[model samples]
Target: MKRAEQVTFGGGGLDRAAHLRGDRGALATAWADPAAAVLLVWQGKPLSTRSGRGSSPDQLVMIRPDHPLAASHRENCIFLGLAPTGAPQFACDISSWQPDALDQAMLASFADASEQQHPDLPTGQVFTELRRMMAFLTPLEAELAATANAVLSWHKSHQFCACCGQPSQVAQAGWQRNCAACNTSHFPRTDPVVIMLITHGDQVLLGRSPGWPVGMYSLLAGFVEPGETLEAAVRREVLEEAGVKVGAVTYLSSQPWPFPMSLMFGCAGIALGRELTIDHSEIEDALWISRADMMTVFAGDHPGIRPTRKGSIAHFLLQNWLADTLD
Candidate 1:
């Protein structure tokens, strides 16, 4: 758990100038500066680039202020944090743009970014889903993408005020939304979810949701309910979905899972009993997976099971458990 932040998207030291976000003059200066760079996002995907031949190392597609797409959506540009070295960064959503067929094809290719082409930007750039390319991205790239997707998605969905039935305006460099009708302010929200690595003896509890692909199972997870502690949430979720009692829940690590903004609280727990009584409504199936069988699943040799995808907190926790590194 101590080394948990060392996971992907975990160790980036980006300086998020929270205090300066409310200053209009400072944000304008940063936006107009030549050194300021923007990451393009379209429909929750970030623009990434790859070099010739092989796609071993991929980079985020960063554009200058004067780029054609930089100002395409005047209201969609949100100020992301500054880089470690003090370069200003922003995320611009171009989801409204209509790309041609070729651009669409390039955007869909998760692997081999070398062959992608974008008509709206320079060569060697294509917008792809962050979840697909997260493992290939650097720590900084992962953090930026996660932040951008979460904040932008919030803006897109929360255009109205919850206090009053009036529309809200974005403020604080896209960090806050204010409604004039009721004088109410709203901040970006991150729903807390508890994903547990529950163990009984040598086996761990894994479950599959109803809509997940066949053979895909992950650590049991559920949203934290109102006024509930994280530890309590972990125990409640495991029991609710898998009908297994949990004891001594320990916090493992945290991840910014920005698929519409959620903070994943990774935890490890001890299952009080191993009897399987799955709630078919919450999870399609639940079973205990031995450490040996999990090894095969992670190794791509399992005949009927595939481990959780890389770059997810579930995968991170399971991998550490296998190596006996969950300290």
Candidate 2:
């Protein structure tokens, strides 16, 4: 657990500059700085530029506010924070532009392609999905992309105040929404999810959601409901989904899963009994796999089952567990 934050999207030591968020003048000065940079996003994807040579490196595509593309879309710009170097950083959503015929054709090549180009910028700049490019990005880049996507997604869904059903306007450096009619203020939300590594002796439990890709399984997981503790959520979820009682849950690590904002609480729990009466409504299948077979799954040598996705907290825990290094 010592290297827990080393997980993808977990270790961006960003200076959020939260104290300056409420200062309109400070926010203005940050963005106006010549060194300020913005990460462009379209839909949920962040813009990235790659060297044409396959051996070369890929990087996040950043531009100044004065850049043509950054200037093109000002309505949805968000102040992310100051970079490690103390330069201002921001995210701009350009989801509204339409691509040309050539760009449209280029977009078909990747699952989430960056076919649309600013007339002033080079051709390789494309908005690509974070999942596909996560491994290629640095910790800071991943954090910026995740934060932008999560906060922007929240704004898109929470245009109206929940308290009084009145329209809300962006405030506090894009961190809050204020409603004039109801005097209600709302902040960005991050749901807590408990992803448990349940063990009984040398075996671990894995489950497949109803519509997951064939052969794909991960640690059993669920949201922490209102008024529930993280430990309680783990026990309740395991019991509810697989009908397997758990005891002595221990915190492992955490990951920021920004598919619309979730903080995955990784934990290990002891299984009191082995019987599994799977709740079909919660999961498609659940089973216990021995440690030896888990080794094969991680190596991609298993006969039928695919391991959990790399860079995930479940994969992180299982890898350390295999190495006897889960400290």
Best by TM-score: 1
lDDT string for model 2 (1-327, tens) is 788888888888778989988888887788789989999887677888852237655578988898877876655578889989999998887767666554654443323434456556678876666766776678998889889989988988999999989899988878999999989999999999999999999999999986576899999999999999999999999999999999999998898888878999999999999899999999999999999999999999998899887667788888888887778
**lDDT per residue as tens, model 1, 1-327:** 677887777777878999779888888888887789998887777888753237566678888877887876545578887998888899987777665544555554433232334586777687666666787788888899899999999988999999887999988888999999999999999999999999999999999987576799999999999999999999999998988999999989999899879999999999999998888889999889899999999999999898798888899999999999999
Q: Distance from true position, residue 170, model 2, in Å?
A: 0.6
Backbone N/Cα/C clashes per model: 0, 2
Query: Candidate 1 clashing pairs?
Result: none
lDDT of 1 at 242: 85
- Model 2 gets an lDDT of 0.84
Q: What is the C-alpha RMSD of each candidate to the true structure, in Å?
A: 3.1, 3.1
In model 2, the clashing pairs are: 1-327, 114-126
Runs in model 1 lying further than 4 Å from the true structure: 50-55, 101-118
